[model samples]
Target chain A: MEQRLGLEASIAIAEVVCRCDVDIVAAYPITPQTHVVEHLSELVADGELDAAFVPVESEHSAMSVCCGTAAVGARTFTSTAAQGLALMHEILFIASALRLPIVMAVANRSLSGPISIWNDHSDVMTERDVGWVQIFAENAQEAADLTIWSFRLAEDRRVSLPVMVNFDGFILTHTIEPMLMPDKEMVQAFLPPWEPLLKLDVDEPISMGPVGIPDIYTETKQVQQHLLTQAYGPIVETLNEFAQHFKRTYKPIETYRSDDAEVLLCTMGALSETAMEVVDRRRKQGQKVGLVRIRLWRPFPFEDLYRAVGNVPVLGVMDRAISFGGPVGPVASEIKAAFYHREQRPKIVEFIAGLGGRDVPLSDFGRMFDSLYTTGETGKIPAPTIIGLRE
Target chain B: MATQSAKPKWTELAVGTAITVPGSARQNRTGDWRSSRPIWNHEECIRCGVCVIFCPEGCIHFDQDQPGYPSADLEYCKGCGICAHECPTACITTQEEEE
Candidate 1:
């Protein structure tokens, strides 16, 4: 029987990875993400997880080792955040382009300029175009559940793309919460062993990363893009599969009371949980309000987003990441493109908030809704408001 | 105009006849590692021992004579070709096999 246990998101993530029985874990310790890898290292040390743990020198080498191990038909994993992830950006693109199903945990943190150890979406925003399936977790429970789903979605022969599960640093990463831990046998039934299509073998003598001539270079990229674009159906299928075993169902975009609502609040990552209470409080006050939680950001679930907020007069997008000199936040920008051709579209307002670990209180979200409802009537996209900034 | 000519620099183009590699160089295999099959032009000889000293893996050795020239031990060489690049007379050629 399964039991509910209060666990830090970092440790919970490690538990599911251990249950998946990964063949290789190449990792380097870094802030916020450190506890996850540390627990994994302990698991390897104690013989609970029988895998090759390569204690690498840097995040670059860590991902490089992951690329090498995954190329040879081994299930590989790693974790990092902030500068550690920025260091691995070059290798991150290669991991997906080569179609290696390497699963990684990103303890979301602020990118350094003023040098913050706090949580933010800057690191993930910089890597938004890197061809990996990115998911944001709303709590410790989601973090644990998403890790199991990540492997299933990634290793599906149809997908074969890397997956990144982002949990907010300090807020969810260090916070303990009660989560249902599924049994190993259940997870075994959920995620099967990875069987690679093309791997380096002595008998076959196949090549990886070969220098193709100009004649075939475009075709290679076209095939990679086609395979990833076709992955949407399988991604949804696997998520529904996981939800069938577990109680909670996660989608690309989750709707909370979105039906017949006038205004919809959009958010990603752990902050969505905080936004939910704000939606709940105002709903009791007779405000036709709802929330749209974006769990997957890279594929940018266009159809689901359009359907969730259908015919709402005002749609407010809450961004933890900034695109500087752009109107829409990362999520909002993608949503706007989905409605470009539609004759009737909701007035989409963008709110850049909670950067560098600012606390987004209930009052801040209240102010955002009021501002959008008033200014949104004129139909011109209002200047985005930054909530909880250090002005 | 001469600097921007269509002709490539001599250093950029390989001059010697091509050699062939038999197996993968990227993996740490268990068996005897493949080596570069080196050819020596006896006429272009000064007997400088640069190739033997420059080998990082130390798979190169001297001939059995008073004037000892360099030869590679194929059983141990991983085909990195440090010996071919360091040859003073430019007599040795190396080739990496296509996949």
Candidate 2:
């Protein structure tokens, strides 16, 4: 049975992890991400969850421990934030390369220098090429649901890659929202015990993560790349299976009132909810504006994004992270590249907003929509605008 | 001995490129990288088995023909000169490879 309860998103996510029957929870405590591991430790300590709670000295060790445990066929998990995620950088690549299906919840936060402990996509953007299956959640409910889904998607035989569930630090992690909490039985039925395709066993005596010499290194990378790219099909199939079992539909790219519109605003994470409200307000004022929220960030849903945009002439892409000297923001750059070869594509206006825990109020979204409407008329894509930047 | 076989295609590689076969490291002949070979003077050799113990690759062993004299298995010896340096009797010497 499922019961609705007002729960902090981090705690909710921890509960979902418990229901998944994770074998090991190895993590270091970082702000925003701290509560998640904290609650998980409590669950293990209080005897509510039967699992090994490894209190690692650092985030790097946390991920390294997950790799070892998962290699031995243990359903492993971990969580971290900005600097912590960065600390786990090198191991993140090894986890994916070794095909360890470890599940991680990243409380998306900004990187340092003029140091900040606030929410942003900077942390995740830094590891964009780490080869993990990354996804974003729009709210607490989605965060909790996606955490469970991540484990399923990652452990699939055809897609044995680690999965990172990204939800804004503080904003989504600390906020309390009413969500239908599914019982252990429900989650068990939806996600069966992980059946690893290969594991480290003394009886079988197989070696993992061996050295690839020059002759075989390229072939090894080619195989890994092929597996990652082809994981798209398995991701969709797993999501579909979850939807059928849980009665909650989730798509790679979710659209709100974008079936027929002249302009659309693209966003990810919790900001998409605010964007949805802005779309509603704009529609009431007789403007054909809608919203496009990307749920999948890696093995990016290029086809779904194209199908969602349809013939919309203008698109306002909101990014929470800057790509420095390169193309304004990482998300916008990807969107541009996805449509580069197309004969017909939307004129994308990139907007960098809500960085470093800065508030992205409804009015900020209103300004983006207004700028998008102007771009629709002028047909000139302006420079990437930094929202609420006083300078 | 490590033999070089034709590399497997990307499609033929196992999942995660895991070497499913245990002890596959033996297939890589490390001696190919050696620039010098070790020459043992059996006359001064003490048969203390010091060279056999000091060889990094453990390629040195008591010769079957000589009963106790140590000989290097050139196939796997990396010519690291550890045996020459560690030989207490100074019986082992290193010679530069010509080919």
Candidate 3:
């Protein structure tokens, strides 16, 4: 059951979710995300996978159907991109607040109005506060691995939060890569069938989607917040277990060449691999530059990121999407906010780049370092600059 | 045995909380919290049935030619505020429970 030949990450994800024995998958056809559902549909047609594959009309309906199926104690999954995710924006909050352990694959893409069918962080950046556990993938291997990892994290009794594994749309989805596909039995053992503590049951005859009075509404939200924050410890433990079994190490935040470096470049997703290359090349030139790769975006990973970047003289925060009115990029803004109230902090510089699938050449890392160094010395905010934009 | 002492401790706990529990009150109406007080503006009514059709919870009802909307089941409204937001002419309002 191993295919070394070329296969898209989206299709690989489809195969893994099918083999994982997902009870239901409700997805709408959208660019980048369509291949995932299309492959799953073929699995259903050929009788390879025994699951309810609902081809919903819109992403909103897709997510709504997933919520319904997952709430009934079914292990459910779905995929969407860009405006499709924008349409599911309202129910996204409900899925998380209700604490359904539904997992989603978000083929990250730019938001529309200019309507670009390319890669960007705009789609996920807008839903940052939707209360889902967000994890970014650097490659097809991480993308597939995170999908399995997401299930374990989401279904942990303490968390019970939906997870969105965000991978750049065209960068990872369409790119052909040789991925190490784990054995089906191993994945099955790693992620057992989801048995919810509370779900719709015919024999039990319990009411779900109940009305929340204000007296109890605040307490429910408090419980959700507490679970999301407290679940981080268990999530780290589960990740360690996955690492031991599969020999794949995943951290909420990781540092490359930061041990003895003076300046650090912060990035996420597929771009971090490119930045790591730059860090290596710069290191050879006797420059004290390191790279901080943020794997988890939501639940903010504040403490992990803070400790990872610790006392570095200069820190460069790079983002793939614009925050519009915000002073810095959305990710950059959050990172800065983490250090703002602290007594000790790194000299932070924010840069927005790689919008609309623009090529982020490795040479841009040098410019980012220069900006960071200047900002640290001058005690002035660096102008939000784009590294790889066409004039 | 430990089991014998645990039984008396359970009774003591029940007795301690009994003093705070209302002795005379037979039952409390928790349903009052969900009951909606729908207010209709007679002047702004177009009688379009927009609120009725848009109510996903199906808590609003009105005659086709009525001057104002009527409540089909106020007890089940859950106060989602969809009817209030969906009123085309802004004629209807759903109220919150007063503490």
Candidate 4:
């Protein structure tokens, strides 16, 4: 049975993690990500969840503990935001290289220089090559659902890789929304007990993450690269299976009314909801506009993206983070590279918006669509624009 | 001398490059790397077992036939000269290998 409850996204994600029956929850508390581990600790302390709750000193130690537990065949989880995510950068690569199935929730927040603790993709964008399967959630419901799906995806034998679930800080983390909370029995049916492909055991000793000398270093990296690339199939299969069991469909690239659209606006995370609303207004005004939201950040979902934007003359890509003097925003840069060789591709208009927790109002999205319309007519790509910039 | 002849292909490597075998260090004979070899003058040697204790490889032991006299097992010794350097009775000396 499913129970509908109004819950904070962070708390809902924690509840989903508890239902997954994770063996270990090792984490350090950071803002926006604090509520998740805090609730999880209460669950463990109250005997509602039987798991080891390691209160690590720092985010680096948290990820280190996750790696240790996951290596010993324990289902492990952790959560962090912004600077905390940045601190775990070193271990992030090691966890995936060693093929530890550790699931993490990153409440997306802006990185510091001027020191802002607001929602943005800067933290995750900097970790693009860390080799973990990254996914973004639009709202509370998707955040909870993806947290559950992340465990299944990570523990899949065919795709034994770590997963990071990203949801906007404060926007999703602090907001309370109605979500269908699946009971323990349903979660058990969807995700079976984690059966590790390899583990650290004294009885049958095996060395994991052995020193790859020059003779074998390249070969080991080649294997890891191939495994991550091939993991796309398993990810899609897992999502399809989840849809069948839960009766809720999710795609790597989700489209809204884009079939006859002349200009499609693309975005990720909670901003997509606002973009969708803007698209509706434009459609009402007889403008052929649509929305494309990226759910999967890694493995790039090249095929799904091409199919979603098929023949759409203009694509307004809204990025939450800048690439620091690069030709376009990080998300837009990837999109441009993906379409570089293709003969039929959209004229992508890059946009950097909602930086350092700045609000991206409906008017801003309206402006993006207008620019897309102009680009569609002129067929000329303009310089990247920063939405809502004061000066 | 036990070095593997053919390395496994990338496809054939174990997941995460985990080594499934235990105590594989014994299979690698490091003696071939020796640039010099240790020789013992058993006549002046005390059976204090100091050389046996100081040999970095733990390759020095009392000669089976000559009882208390310590000798280096050339099979695994890298001729580090640790035993010669640590010999209290000055009974051990290192000589450069001909080859």
Candidate 3, residues A1-391, lDDT tens digits: the string is: 3345467889888888887888899999898887888999999889888999998889999999998998788999999999999999999988887778899999999999789878989999999878788899998888888899898888887778899999889889999888888778889888887768667666654444544444445555665566677778877999999898788899999899998888898999988988998888888989888989999887778889888988887888999888787765888888888999988888778888889888888778778887777877788877778777668
Window of ten residues with lowest summed lDDT in model 3 chain A = A206-215
Identify the runs in model 1 with alpha carbons over 4 angstroms from their true place.
B1-99
lDDT of each: 0.81, 0.90, 0.80, 0.90
Candidate 1 residue lDDT tens string, A222-320? 655666667778889988888888867989889888897778888888888877888899889998788888888867777888788888888888888
Question: Model 1 residue A164 lDDT?
Answer: 94
- Misplaced by over 4 Å in model 3 are A1-5, A389-391, B1-99
Residue by residue across A51-145, what tens digits does model 4's lDDT show? 99999999999999999999999999999999999999999999998899999999999999889889999999999998899999999989989
DockQ of 1: 0.04
User: TM-score of chain A for candidate 1?
Assistant: 0.97
Residue pairs clashing, model 4: none
Q: Write the per-residue lDDT of candidate 2 for residues A1-391, one digit (tens) a residue.
A: 7899998889999999999999999999999898999999999999999999999999999999999999999999999999999999999999998899999999999999769999999999999988899999988888989999999999889899999999999998999999989999999998888899899999998888877778888877776778888999998998999888888889999999999888899999998998888888889999888999999998898999999999889998999999888987999999999999999899999999999999999999999999998998898899999999999
RMSD after Cα superposition, model 3: 10.1
Which candidate achieves the best TM-score against the true structure? Answer: 2
Q: Model 4: residues >4 Å from true position, as ranges? A: A325-328, B1-6, B29-51, B61-99
Q: Is the docking of candidate 1 incorrect, acceptable, medium or high quality?
A: incorrect
Clashing pairs in 2: none
